[model samples]
Target chain A: MSRTRVHNFTISLDGFATGEGLSAEQPFGHAGHRLHQWMMATAFGAPIMGLPGGSSGVDNAFAQQHEPGIGAEIMGSRKFGPPGWQDDPNWRGWWGPNPPFHTPTYVLTSRPRSPLEMEGGTTFHFLDAPGAEALKIAQEAASGKDVRIGGGPTMLRDFLAAGLIDHLHVVQVPVLLGRGVRLWDGLEGLEQQYQVETVSTPSGVTHFTFSR
Target chain B: MSRTRVHNFTISLDGFATGEGLSAEQPFGHAGHRLHQWMMATAFGAPIMGLPGGSSGVDNAFAQQHEPGIGAEIMGSRKFGPPGWQDDPNWRGWWGPNPPFHTPTYVLTSRPRSPLEMEGGTTFHFLDAPGAEALKIAQEAASGKDVRIGGGPTMLRDFLAAGLIDHLHVVQVPVLLGRGVRLWDGLEGLEQQYQVETVSTPSGVTHFTFSR
Candidate 1:
């Protein structure tokens, strides 16, 4: 069965998924970009970005898990693009040529846009459907593989509220931004139960996998 | 003389400061309320909340640090209320009667609101100033004591952009909200440095104080 899993999401001490105000110059906002420092240095990141030579130790092991059998991905509008840029429908993503995900990606957006075709196997499909509808589409597209929930706190909140996500992995960095768009803002009544699957990594990146 | 200090702040491994959708019933969101579980058992938390008996060992020591002398507190509008709530001029804060902070607090917002008076010396003053200005007000109100930058991320990002914060103590708990808010988003260009002051806690609360 294809399951919706949220993996390798990094967050700051304050409680923001990504920094507020999306822009090409400042994609993740002020301190928001610091969340990916660990992933950028690992072997997993090297191959993904087409870089040469990277460490394959514990860091690499954790990084490898980020991209497994991910057949499809879902992200919020903020993670997709700026407001006006979406109108063109040609602008794919912040990541230029040879994007990360080499698979189908479903973007949750209010505005209507055509499916974006990238260099790799990645296809950005803008979904006007509601949260559950988008998830269903992504799940079907995922085949038997797992569907990754690419984030922007609001999107994740929607999935979490609907009890659609099965697994979650968050990498807590050592920095503190103090403020931004909080991911935990409207998640009060969710009655879900999760347990710590594993806890390793001494470099402050603690990997936690929770299941409903 | 600017001294580096780490005010012990506990966070879940999933990167939630408190819980989602902070309401009077559920101040902390879903599993997020448990983020402060370690602190509540500490001696510092017990005494502050007027609890008679509590753990007095290392947990207490760490918890005591959380109550570091704060001359003033800085928060964003979101931490105070919703978007237009500031227009009222009479709406104080979520904290009724006795607020958490006994000292003065400076709220960062675009629209101006009247000073909110609370019992036990807590007063909310709106500051239209930017990150630097708010820090200046906090520093003055601190009266040589440290000024705490409390929030929801945007406010913290501003202070971090200005390189004002001296120390940061982050406690990593075990839990993942999958998404809510993140702390380190827009902190890329600023050049800052830090050294770990201390790391000792049995309750999984690792204290790290950074200095430039």
Candidate 2:
């Protein structure tokens, strides 16, 4: 069924899924990048980033599970980096000409901008509408496939707090960042129950499937 | 300079810090109780465990700073859960009745057992020797100050991996069960760059400090 799923979200041990003061220089925090260590080592990560002869094993097996049948992808403006609206235009989305997400993408932002078209069927549409509105557009664009909630913590918190998400898959990586932005913050007053659907991969990358 | 540091240890998002298939309905996982979530929450996660009017703000503050100047403490057999050893007697070396490790602690174990007793202190020792030996006997016990390593994952991994620990504070909480008794799996190639110093907690809890 079509549902909103936050997939492959990694959190630090200090409750931070992402670090504060995020920038292109430090995409994730010092230890934060370590969270994706497993994913990056996977066959899935190698090919997507255009690496040759990737190592295959338990790590690769788990990496293969990351590409969750994405119909559409949604992200925040901050995640796209380069603050402020692009005036000169030439700001070809975050992932260069060929992004990993090969689907329609809706970016939530305040500034109005034209749709960014990229190679590999990836299009970045800047939505000035509220988060809910952006989600709706993405869902429709998904066309029966699942809408992936790509993030920067704040955006995910907004949707999660608003009760707009149908499922969440959190991958907790074993690394400690003394300071950073936490994932569980501001998520108060939401009573939710989730059963661990599956547990695989010992590369320290654990996946929890949650449905409400 | 004794201070408290919050270490964010990574657990799978599946709610299983270790893996599944625990015996005697051990909530953590079969033998997975060896993974110390409780101790991490105790030493660092005071707020998350809902410590009677705990605040995220308080937790976050401690999390940001580096904890300095810690001394000694105690650990029980029950804390480590089921070891792979067969049961035996004459091994009484956990925290004693009113143990004297007000500073920090270190526990040693091979099998589940009762508490220990020492002059002006306590001693609850287990059969699991070599694996937990060097850590059990250290000078920290004589100086009356340093740090202690807990028996569970919190005590061992946090100290060993982060290279923050100066002593081992192991509390082997007494609980019986079968299966899942491998303390240091997946931790073979840590690439650690540190020197091991030995110390001990008064309550028979041994301490091993790794210095860089």
Candidate 3:
């Protein structure tokens, strides 16, 4: 079945998925890629940094699930680029010509813009609508595969609170980021809707998967 | 060597150790016994509920560490009882005549009162001292054994921020308590000092241990 999913989304022990003060200079702000170092070290995301040898353990196993069966991705504008990316017509993306997401990627932003097709199958479509409407568009674009809710915390929380997610994968990195966008802000009693499973790897990252 | 430790300290995914509005009626407030239901199902803590046939797996193994080497315990006033517990001279504790800690138990409160000795070796001593001073007193009472820093979030954060903790064991309960006392507040960059370990058991609770 085609499901709305999130995979390998990283967060600190304090629940900050992304940090404060996101900019073009530092996309992840004060967090500075600490939250995602686990995923980045995986076999799936490691190739992005041009790293040859990466662990293919539980982390890589989870990271590799991000792409398979995912025909389209719906991410926030912040995940696409830093703040004011909408203003910069020249701003392509943080991930150069060939981005990792080789899917029909939809970027949620207040200001709508024309679609930018990258070298890979990845194409950024600007959407000025709520999570449900955006998901509908992405699901249709997914072509019977599945819609991936790529996140930056705000959009993920919105979808989770809106009960639009089917399967979710969150990596709990041990680092305690004091301040940032939180994943569990409005998700009180989230366990009621989804069955949660936790697996702690030898590399010190606990993978939490929630599926309804 | 004397080591300061915290054990079986349960908190929600959002880092809330306990819920709001704690009282004698509902000691854990809206959270009730949910935060600690995992521990209550363990072989160690299950005995308190007078229940049999609890699991003897990783959860029980970790839960068993709560009372092993510690000679004394220092807990916040909130953990001792409800608000205005001092006002009610009849208020002994939530744990009946034979309280769990069979050692010198120090309760941190602004309003100090005379020591209350229970049936077992547990004796509640009210102290108005800060984390450091209180640690000194507890350490002295410990007589070379380790001191367990029992908590209710605020006091644990204070002790942690003060760098007074040597070993910490936190159980990440799957529940999301939206509003309550947070364990990770003012504890940014906590991962820097402690060598952390994450373990997820079959019972669906993740155990986080930080040892300096």
Top candidate when judged by TM-score against the true structure: 3
- List model 1 lDDT by residue over B1-212, tens digit each: 42323355555544545555655455554544476767777666765556667788866776566456777888878778754575666677877788878888888888877788899988989889887777777777778887777766555656666677776665666555555554455564332366534343555554545556
Per-candidate TM-score against the hidden true structure: 0.60, 0.55, 0.98
Please compute DockQ, using alpha carbons, for every candidate against the native two-chain complex.
Answer: 0.10, 0.05, 0.91
Best by lDDT: 3
Q: What are the per-residue Cα lDDT tens digits for candidate 3 across A155-200?
A: 9999999999999899999998899889999788988888999889
User: Model 2, B92-195: lDDT tens per residue?
Assistant: 33323444343324455444354445554434444444333434343244253343444444345534554445432222211222223323333432324434
Model 2 bad stretches (over 4 Å) = A29-33, A55-62, A65-68, A85-88, A188-191, A197-200, B1-212
Model 1 stretches with alpha carbons more than 4 Å out: A189-192, A197-202, B1-193, B196-208
How many clashes in each candidate? 38, 52, 0
> How does residue B168 of candidate 3 score in lDDT?
94
User: Which model, 1 or 2, shows the larger DockQ?
Assistant: 1
Inter-residue clash pairs, candidate 3: none
**Which window of 10 residues has the lowest lDDT sum in candidate 2 chain A?**
A188-197
Q: What class would a CAPRI assessor give candidate 2's docking? A: incorrect
Provide the lDDT at A156 for model 2: 87
lDDT, model 2, position A88: 43
Residue B66, model 2: lDDT of: 25
What lDDT score belongs to each candidate, Candidate 1 first? 0.69, 0.52, 0.90
